[model samples]
Target: MHVGVLGAGIVGLATAWQLSRRGFQVSVVDRAEPGSGASGGNGAQLSYSYVQPLADPSIWKQLPKLLLSPSSPLKLRPQLDPLQWRWGLAFLAACNARTSRQTTAQLLTLAAESRAAFEAMLAALEPDCDFSATGKLVLYGSASSLEAAGRQLELQRAMGSEQRLVTPEECIAIEPALAAYRRQIAGAIHTPSECAADCLKLCVALEGALRARGVRFLLDCEVQGFDRHHGRDGRVRAVLTSAGDLEADAFVMALGTASHRLGRRLGAYLPVYPLKGYSITVDVDPASEGAPHVSVTDSARKVVFARIGSRLRVAGMAELVGHDASIPATRIETLAAATRAVFPQASRMAALHPWTGMRPATPTGVPIIGRLPRAPRNMLFNTGHGALGFTLAFGSAERVAAQLAS
Candidate 1:
């Protein structure tokens, strides 16, 4: 059985690997190189414990302030598009406590599953992804936010997460680099079991493994449309690409934000929207200066910092401004300033490599992973992972493979 997987990002590559493992010939199609999308240079934190939805009740209260403020973590540029409005309204509707809690529970389960799957892959492949069990420190800037986060630790514990609330002093004790901002830090939640790894490295390793396993990679191939077969179970007979039409026994749509456009053409209501985000990698002198060895999350700034070898990866912010991949100068400046305020001597910040990408997000913030309706009986989808694309990829691939097998 030959399966054609669309989108050569991390999710698509992982799905192809899973399908190949299941005795299926896999071919991945993409317009560019693998990991060139959101999978490239992400925050690098395997956040199995911090699987909370973005549209919580607190966001409703903070929406106006976040939009109006110049230095807010989240930004939304409203447009005249009905698609954006519809997705915005759906997100607002999901801001209730009940819905937020339900989404968190579901995400926690998936996060745990993803962590296990990632560990298994690391053990089997021994890939050089800068895999490090450095733990994670989520620093809060306010007492209220710290209190709320501390309270949430109980819920995480109940859901099989290992974390503990720590004081600002203890936070610095865990990662002495944070001593630079001791006065600014209020409290923190330290998850000892969490890990950080280079996402792009992992993607490259997966792509190489797939090639070694005889999976075909069709790069620079733009998928235009699909040819359907008329039967009791209507399926995609072939996928029309710029190169040519390629037929497969099964198809998977792992296209990130582009999945929304494709799903709409197929008559499916996919509420995935692009959330633009930025990141800057800075070289750090780990020996002379105090660079944080553990991954750190700034609760106030919504930014995360991780030490991927000698380079420090800083990423954050969510801008709802459509599919534009242009990097905003102000946003990048803000991220650099915020990260420096926390760790002054961690990075030189002079030669920073900035990058921006569109993250495919759903209203509830959980990815849409399943087979499509009966019309595309042989088709499956695994996208809309937002900021957790790398964190959720392998587990999602396993789910898709199981669905196709069934």
Candidate 2:
């Protein structure tokens, strides 16, 4: 079978890799180079145990505060578009405890599956992506939030997670870099099995491996439309692209936010929207006492710090203002302030490199990974991963490949 995969991000590359493994002739098409999108320069934390969905019961109360606060990690720019209103309403509907808990459970299973798949790739591919099982520590500031998180640990434990709650002193003992903010932390959660890596490096390595295995890459190729003929087993005759019309036995839409635009041409409704996020990578001095070996999450500020090799990655903040991937000055400053406050001597602020990407998000925070009902049978979707795209890429590819094989 011949498969033409759309988008060259981590998800698309992983899917193409899996399809090639299944003995399919694959061609990947994308407008930019691999990993240039959200897959590049993410938070770098492979949060296997922390699989909580963004739409939780607490968000209902904190939404207004998050929007109004200048330094808040979340920003909401109200849009006049009907699609924006629809997504917002659906997001609001998913803010209840029932929906949040259900989504978390589903995400946990997928996250574990992804971790195992990633481990297998690490052993076989051995990509130089700074892969490590450095573990993770999440710091909570308020006593109330800490207590709530502690209560939630029981449920996570029941789901087979090995995360445990730790006191502020224990947190400092585990990660000495937190000594500066030890006085302000109320509590912490530690997951010893979590890992971290550079997502872009992994994508580049995978792309090279796939090329060596006879996969074709159509870089700078923009997909315009598809030539389809409706039937019992609907198939895409050819994919119209900026380069030329490419024909394949199967087509996969992994185009992140752009997937919605292409899906609309086929009369498919994809609830994927762009969630803009920012990150700054700074060189960590070897002699610095504030450099952390383990991945750290400041729960209060919603910022995460992960040390990938000699660099510290500081990332957070989500804006629901459509597909603008430009970095905001205030948000970048907020990240720098939070990093300096927590890990005082970790990085030189003047030398940090900043970046922004649009994470394809869904209302429930779970990715869509299946063939759309109204779309062609040969067409499959693997987008809307939101913030966890890097974390879930491998497992989602495995699922999509299984469906295609069946």
Candidate 3:
């Protein structure tokens, strides 16, 4: 079967990879090059074990700060658009313990599968993307929060996640870069099997591999609409694009935030919104001081730092203010400040490359990974991965390919 996968981000590329390997002809369509969206500048942490959803019970307490404080890690500006209000209401509805834990459980399963699939792909291709399995530390600032994390740790343990609560001293021993900021640390939860890699380089590698396997890429191609088949009920024969009507036996809507509008055209409702995020990549000098080899996430600030080769990727902040692509100066400064406070000497501000991308988020934080009810038989979904797009791409790709095959 011939399959046309929309969006050239990691998810679409991975889906194309899976389908091609399964003996299907594949084509990737995107307005830009692969990994040019959220995949290019994400958190870079392959958080396999710490797959917690954002709409946890804790968000209830921070609702005020989320609205009032501009400096808060999560920013929510009520938009005039109805979809924003709808998405916000659903997100608020999901802010409960039971629902949060349920979402976490599902995310953990998908993340585990993604890790396995990602590893298998890495072993086969051996792409030079600064891949590392040095593990990760999620630092809590208070003893109370540390205790709270312990309860969630137990739940994850039951789900087969190898996580452990570590003391501030032990955290220092595990990652010496934390020594400078030792006084602020209350405790940390460490996951030894977590990994990190350069997502953009990985996407480039996937594109190269897919090309070698006879897969086509329609870069700079805007998908306007679709040409429907009248014989089949709501079946799409081809996607009408700026390039032309590219016919295919099957179609996969892997366009992240853009999937919602496209789905509406095809009579599907995807509760996907753009949760904007920011990141700053800084050049590091290893000889000067303690450069963190292990990935670190500041739980209080919701900022993450990962060492991808000589550059440190510092990313954080979740803004729900519609599709405003402007990168504010303060947001960039916040990430730069986080880098200073976390690992002072890890990077110099001279070469800080600031970037912003809208994460295609769902209210529940769990990705929409299969064909929806209203979607055509040939239509499938692998979008709405939100911030975990890089982490869950391979596993979702595997599932979507399997769904098509069945």
TM-score of each: 0.98, 0.98, 0.99
For 1-406, candidate 2 gives per-residue lDDT tens digits of: 8889999999999899888888889999999999999989799999888877888888978888766876668878787877788888899899988898788888899998888877877888889998878799989998999888886777788888999999999998889988999888999989988889999999999999999999999999999999987677557889999999999988889999999889988878998988889999988876777899989999888899998988899999888888776677888888889889999988777676889989999999999998988888889999999999999998999888888899
Q: Pick the candidate with the highest TM-score.
A: 3
Task: Give the least accurate 10-residue stretch of model 1, judged by summed lDDT.
Answer: 370-379
Better of 1 and 3 by lDDT: 3
Candidate 3: deviation at residue 381, Å?
Answer: 0.5
Displacement of residue 72 (Cα, Å) in model 3 is: 1.0
User: What is candidate 3's lDDT per residue for 286-389, written digit by digit as tens?
Assistant: 57666799999999988999989888899999999999989999999989888898898786678778899999999999999888998888889999898899
Which is the leading candidate under lDDT?
A: 3
lDDT of 1 by residue, 325-406 (tens): 8887898898889877988888767777999988899998989998766338787899999998988888899999888888
Candidate 1 C-alpha error for residue 406, in Å: 1.7
Candidate with the larger lDDT of 2 and 3: 3
CA lDDT of each prediction against the hidden true structure: 0.87, 0.89, 0.92
